[model samples]
Target: MQLGTFSFVTKLAGFEYTKFVRYDDEGDLRVIKAENAGPHGFKTTNYSRVRSSSVAELTRSRLHGGELLMVFVGAGTGNVATVPEGKDFFLGPNIGMMRVETDTVSPRFVELFLRSSVGKALATAAMKAVAQPSLSMGTIRQIPVLLPPAEEQQEILRLVEQALTAAAECGADVREQQSSADILRQSILAAAFRGELA
Candidate 1:
């Protein structure tokens, strides 16, 4: 099934990318910058904040938890992510958003498909601009979508999530081992210097 046929609500935030922030940890809104938008989930702790005066804009631009956020410009052109529930963020510029109209499609399913190799190829081909690669609302809408049976879609998303969780655990384990090795080496060196390792 093609994407444009749905009651899908797609949008590109106002032109002010994630800029001009005096980050306040306790700020009301989390401003999604192009840099923090990733293939997995976002790096929430490192994002910018929405000022009190500008906070009203969030009423319109704030994410409703399940929409897929795509980087439409600069180095992150084709990357996409869905902000987790309970946390809302204002869409920054160069970022295009696809609000999941779940009655017709699942948000996680759509996001996972778009992040796949074939989906990325479609986005790469549709993108424009040389200096700062960008995608317009029209170009994004034109990208092809392959809709599988609902059961198949659910299974794929479940498996992918499980694999990602395992991979992340392995990465953390590797980092922990590396840190332990470094500390062991330092202790060995200290002992040798004190003639205790002779």
Candidate 2:
């Protein structure tokens, strides 16, 4: 079955920020926008909040957790993230949320594919070539997905996780090296000021 075939996939409707959005410091529902969804994952620390009352009107936008979020509009278009379970997040403008109803197809697997080079190319090709490139829900549904065996899919996910963990560690190492270099430069500057270098 294709993505939009309702039998296996459920596409959540996104609400326009200007029309239904009312940011409240006390709001319990956080809006996950394009910026919130990135390569690494959804950034939970900082995001706009909408009143629960406003969200009650648009129940479809409320994330049920495990939904694959895709940014469909603007420069950050095609960015994807998996909504963490137990988080109260609402779909913001320029983004779309999709939920896989069947346990046979893992949402994470779909997310990984969507972030892959092949998936990105497919999405890019499907996008409307306007000044602001965008992918409609219809276009998204039309995009083909290859289904590997369940065991194979699991193996692929495990490998991706391992690679991501290594990448994160490497990033940390780079940052540490940069910090050490900065400290060494400062120490050298301080020694020069004190006339320690003969």
- For residue 28, give model 2's deviation from the true position in Å: 1.5
* Clashes within 3 Å, all models in order: 0, 0
How do the residues 43-154 of candidate 2 rate in per-residue lDDT, one tens digit apiece?
6668788788876877777886888887888887888888989877887777788777776777888788878888777766788889998888888777676768778889
**What are the TM-scores, per candidate, against the unseen true structure?**
0.80, 0.88
Give the winner by TM-score. Answer: 2
TM-score of 2: 0.88
lDDT of 1: 0.71
Clashing pairs in 1: none
Q: lDDT (CA) for every model shown?
A: 0.71, 0.77
TM accuracy, model 1: 0.80
Which residue runs does candidate 1 get wrong by more than 4 Å?
7-9, 12-27, 51-60
Superposed model 2: Cα runs more than 4 Å off: 6-19
Clashes of 1: 0
After TM-score superposition, the amount by which residue 36's alpha carbon in candidate 2 deviates from its true location, in angstroms, is 1.3
